[model samples]
Target: MKKGILILAGIFAMTFVSCKEDAAKKVKEENVEMAEGRDAKNTDFPVMSFAKTEHDFGTINEGDVVEHKFEFTNTGKAPLVIVSAKGSCGCTVPQWPKDPIAPGAKGEMLVKFNSSGKPNQQTKQVTITANTETGKEIIKIKASVTPKAKPVSGTPVSK
Candidate 1:
């Protein structure tokens, strides 16, 4: 009777330990699955696409003010909001639309390049910050300027 009782007690203890371990593993797996689901739903913004990424002014005369329009469309499921537009240098200025663009909607950014003090081959970059997944978009402008000819000096010479 003593032997039978000891064997029975040992079997009961082993069974209880196995059941507890299985329950703990199941809870851990569930927690991990829930965390993954939450991460997938936490996107801040959507994606955007630009119609034209680069602009070439070709050859611009000195002291000329040139402007170009950069067009873009919202290609994602959320609304696109442009926070600000910044130029690489003071000679270049950028302006963005104030209103938010819905999905599949279009918008434009106006950029002006002042060539007053700029000369030779110049390249300028404009950074646009918006409520998009990528956060910032970059646009580039390039121009070549020809300097004005110097005035001729008056001189008398005998041939």
Candidate 2:
């Protein structure tokens, strides 16, 4: 009776394995079809060409708020649509155009950085999601921040 039970369990496991393989093959076929479709439309993808990929603020004081505009041109056959732009941290913010940019047209994204608590040399990145080729683009901003000086301990203040 024990041998018969073991054989039944083995048969069940084999059936499950066969079903999993069949499902995997179906999924693989679907993925291949999707890839083929994407390849066909690859030629129509928009291209985002930026004038400068990185901006340097040189030197800035702490607690200062600064902004920079990044210029770009859609140098592709299709219209360029920027879906979203995200900064690396809360102190960094980005603003981008919501409308679609036509081929050969130009656009700009504004990045704002607040050096309130940030000190020393800092670099931040902005990730832009768009319908352009590669689907995502990255831009950078760097700055050398001069921190504020602290007062001496137990020192008398002079008015």
35-111: candidate 2 lDDT, tens digit per residue: 99989877987899999999999999999999999999999999999999999999899999999999999999999
Top-TM-score structure, candidate number: 2
For model 1, residues 1-159, the per-residue Cα lDDT tens digits are 999999999999988777555556557877889999997897756556888899999999989999999998888888888899899999999999898899888888899999987879999999989878778989999999877665667865559
Q: After best superposition, candidate 1 residue 12: deviation in angstroms?
A: 64
Clashing pairs in 1: none
Q: List where candidate 1 sits over 4 angstroms from the true fold.
A: 1-37, 150-159
**Prediction 1 global C-alpha lDDT:** 0.87
TM-score for each model:
0.69, 0.80
